[model samples]
Target: MLIFPAVKASSRLPATSNNLHPEKHKDLYAVTEQVIARAIPLWNLSLTPVRLPLVSNRIKFKCPEYDMYLEDMSDSEGPRREDAKMSTNEKSAEKNGSATCRTSSNRNLGILSLVSVPPHLEDQYPIEGPRELKPDNTVDIWREYEEDGLQIIAKLANIHLTPEKPEYEGGTWHVEGQLHICASAIYNYDSDNLTTSRVAFRQQSNVQRAELKMSYPQGDHDFLEEVFGCEQGGSGVQDLVTVDNPEGRLLTWPNILQHQVQPFNLVDSSKSGHRKIPALFLVV
Candidate 1:
């Protein structure tokens, strides 16, 4: 069994005053979309949750320039200090202890600092895994079989990309989409002598809230073989299973505003210039 831990989001670019220009904002959204797209493959393979640590309650966003300041809160002090000492060695020890405390405090605070992004964006970056299975003689029918089974589970996890708010003509935009993903896969092998089964559970936040809804749930022991692009009992099963599957799932946004845009004609002079757009835009 193998275990891959979650990777935290680390890149933080200082917010420039002019970063909110229409073109720049569009670019930011595009980059965000790309990140979501790229992350799908990774999510599918790991069978773990993707947690984007960009959002925090302590940070607030102000337009024009995104200023991030730490919240003002008092720190608690422990019990009173021990007796004072004037010895040379004691003084040196105190100085070293203070320095170490400061260093540790700085490190912990740095980790707590949150990265700020446009309010219209949201993401769930997935954690990766090939989590190790326990050793048991009854279940070790084929070492390669167990390995291959895990590889397929990871691959399925990588293909999904959660939707985000779409870019529009106006400066204001809202992200109101919710993504719910769940994957459960099991591998079982049974014969006259021994029987074994390995199960994996991968679930994501489900944002759908309505009376009627549709969902996709797919799983099979054979899916592992299909992901490896091999047939059952084929060669290289062990090596292929051990390899990580990094591709995530993909999703397509519906064309919800198709009729809103007027058709353009080459010969029509009245349609050449841009028209006044409406204030309220709704996507359902």
Candidate 2:
């Protein structure tokens, strides 16, 4: 594990100030430089800190930039050009004059094809999976998170936090649409093997609440990584990134990217060791 030193946000010089001279803020500059030097290891990462009411209790690991350890909050900027690798079925179709490549559609995903888009329905679960998909009905609890959560994400990401669908179509935008809340009970060790990896809308599920979610400490199995070779830094995995799911941190990303949680060994072996996370899917 790579250990990165913590940097305080206050150490940095404020973006807006009347004083133009560096000498005026020399002390602030010195502290800012020191903090940045310590945080050098995280230079390649995009870090955003958010506090949800339920996760920000007196106890538990609480760090402002905890989201840095996780990845995939931003969308791919442009379409990637890849050499076409025809699958057996695709090759057969090509020979029979039934195949026509649509590079435009696949370029954004850096893959051959995408899964069927899930239908949009209010307060209803995604038809493709057996999981809870509820509305943002609990306004009191969610209201606290609105400004700090999606609003901050929107500002940082330069996305509109609109509830309606975005106008851009055909993979132009990765994160889009109004925010949706999904709550579900995580699987125990027995049912862990049965869980399927999926996105929020089969298209955009950014910012999933990952509190008390534990992964197997020691395991030789990662089906998505081993079988599909979908691990970060692997082939055909350029567009997607990996984030370590530390407790109380939120994982944000575009919905089009394929993601999966590796099955992990339970830290504690008891009925009390189950994990549940309420995911907040939105356009920011």
The C-alpha RMSD of each candidate to the native structure, in angstroms, is 27.3, 24.4
Q: What's the TM-score of every candidate structure?
A: 0.14, 0.21
The lDDT, on a scale of 0 to 1, for candidate 1 is: 0.24
The lDDT of model 2 is 0.29
Q: Which digits, one per residue and each the tens of the lDDT, describe model 2 over residues 1-284? A: 11122233322333433332467756644543343333322321211112222221212221111111113323454433344455575467458855233222232232222222222431343334333322332222223332342211111111111123222121232333335422111111122212222222222212112212222112322322432334433444323344444443345443334445543333333322223333323322
Residue 135 of candidate 1: its Cα lDDT? Answer: 39
Displacement of the residue 75 alpha carbon in candidate 1, Å: 34
Q: How close is candidate 1 to the true structure, as a TM-score?
A: 0.14
What local distance difference test score does each model get? 0.24, 0.29
Name the best candidate (by TM-score). Answer: 2
Residue-wise lDDT of candidate 1 within 36-71, one digit each (tens)? 333333333322211212322122221111112223
Which structure among the candidates has the greatest lDDT? 2
Error of 2 at 26 (Å): 49
